[model samples]
Target: MTIRFAAVSACALLTLAACNRTQEPVAPASAAATPPVESPAIPAADPNALTAEGLGPVRIGMTRADLVKLWGEDSQPNAVGGPDPETCDEFHPAKAPADVMVMIQNGVLTRITLTRGATIKTDRGFGVGDSAMAIKQAYGGAIVAQPHKYQDAPAEDLFAWPHGGATTYVTDPAARGVRYEIGGDGKVMKVHAGDPSIQQVEGCL
Candidate 1:
């Protein structure tokens, strides 16, 4: 009888242990799973960014009347009449940025010039104060180095045919580009974006 009682007690203890183990909560299979990390969103292009196309609302091939309507009356006090005053002329829009100037050729907008005091950057990520090397790195083989008209070495015109258009001649009306005029200081003095007019040594040619 004593042996039977001991055997029954041992069986009861084992069953209780098994019940306790089973009663403990079992972890879900996904509990150890990690959530996926999302990548950061890319930044949008600046609206006022200068490009081969144009700057903000001003666009290449736009008519003078359209420009005037957008930025009020245009002013050209230093008109030299390169070939024809009505055709090759430059003007400042009253409501435009202080350092920006527009070139009109054949009665249409052709080039946009960013002079000193301009803080705007090109679509390629360059500005007035950037170095020639910076421009070169931004454009790589697309850059065409030309001798500066006035300054010595280190000062040169860095032209980039960003649109993959004409590389040899500036007469391709369909071609578009940007030019960085590096000064004797080895810093960009001016930036031009538009047609072959960007290759002009003088203001209007």
Candidate 2:
């Protein structure tokens, strides 16, 4: 009877242990792991942004040799009409963006011209197709209005003197500015930036 009682007690304890083991919580398989949140991507800088100093990697007062080195030897130099190369010439580098031209005056880069259909924009946020009113509004009192050399009425020129220096009288070679040529539609036809060459009506003409 003692042996049977001991056996019975051991059996009861074992059954209790089995029952407890079956009831143990498994932590619910750790609820499917959540994915981490991602941040928004940042925009890339514009390579064709026009500015008072220059456009993109090309700056005002850069030398032709510097441009040749920058654009590589394969980048051929294009002359602007009949202008003497010694006085002024335009270079359309093969590596440069389309519709963008650089004027090299006295072997130094003096102006950057953004022609029609160019996606380039001024530092002030003005572009080829922007309206004259938009440019005026963007520049406020910093810009001076002038008659277009070849156009009449709504068409005109907008000159910006960022440092309170006039392009006509300012002799400082470093004096930088921008010029917007407005078409008869009152929309910007072209954009010019850099030194006094920004005022060149005919562009190396």
Candidate 3:
């Protein structure tokens, strides 16, 4: 009887242990979360003005001394290419575009030229590498289309006065204006803007 009681007590203990183990709750797994990053904003670039009046800060009537002030007088200006030695040589300034060339005659800024690689443009937004046909299409019938002095296929040298006057860039009291020199490819090779001095087919002889 004592042995049977001991066996019954052991069975009761085992059943209680099993019940306790099954009743215990399981813990959930934890995860780490990451946040998103924001990007910085960019500023807008300043617009440059090119017209018959001038090219950017260089005006048609500005004095040679004034140019020195703007372009830096680290080196003296060379003699202009035309008949007059007074004009400065077509040299590029560090501040100006790579293709830009400033011309001064009688100590006054007479012309500003734009060749390949220049980003600045006329108020009309015209610049080098533009098509001759594109220019005609944009300006309409007001432009004067001239034949290139050298090229045979495409009529290269094209002249226009978007400001509504037969302006001159030659000599004398040079008038305010601009001119476009296109190449055989029908694309503009040069964009000249300034006083009448800019009209010269070639720089001072």
Best by TM-score: 1
Report the candidate with higher TM-score, 1 versus 3: 1
- Give the clashing residue pairs of candidate 1, or none: none
lDDT of 2 at 66: 90
On a 0 to 100 scale, what is the lDDT of residue 60 in model 2? 85
Question: What tens-digit string does per-residue lDDT give for candidate 1 at 96-175?
Answer: 88888888887899999999999999987899999998778877888999889899988899888867555566778878
Best by lDDT: 1
Residue 43, model 1: lDDT of 88
After TM-score superposition, what is the CA distance of residue 82 in candidate 2 from its true location, in Å?
3.8
- Please identify model 1 stretches exceeding 4 Å from their true place: 1-28, 31-34, 76-83
Candidate 3 C-alpha lDDT tens digits along 33-146: 666676777644334767888755767788877877777542434633456556545556556656677776677777788878887777776788888888888888667776
Candidate 2 residues 112-132, lDDT tens each? 888988887887778899999
Order of candidates by lDDT, top first?
Answer: 1, 2, 3
Relative to the unseen true structure, what is the C-alpha lDDT of residue 173 in candidate 1, on a scale of 0 to 100?
Answer: 85
| lDDT comparing candidate 1 with the true structure | 0.86
Q: How far is each candidate from the true structure, as Cα RMSD in Å? A: 4.9, 7.0, 10.9
Off by over 4 Å in 3: 1-47, 74-84, 162-164, 167-174
Worst 10 residues of 2 by lDDT: 73-82
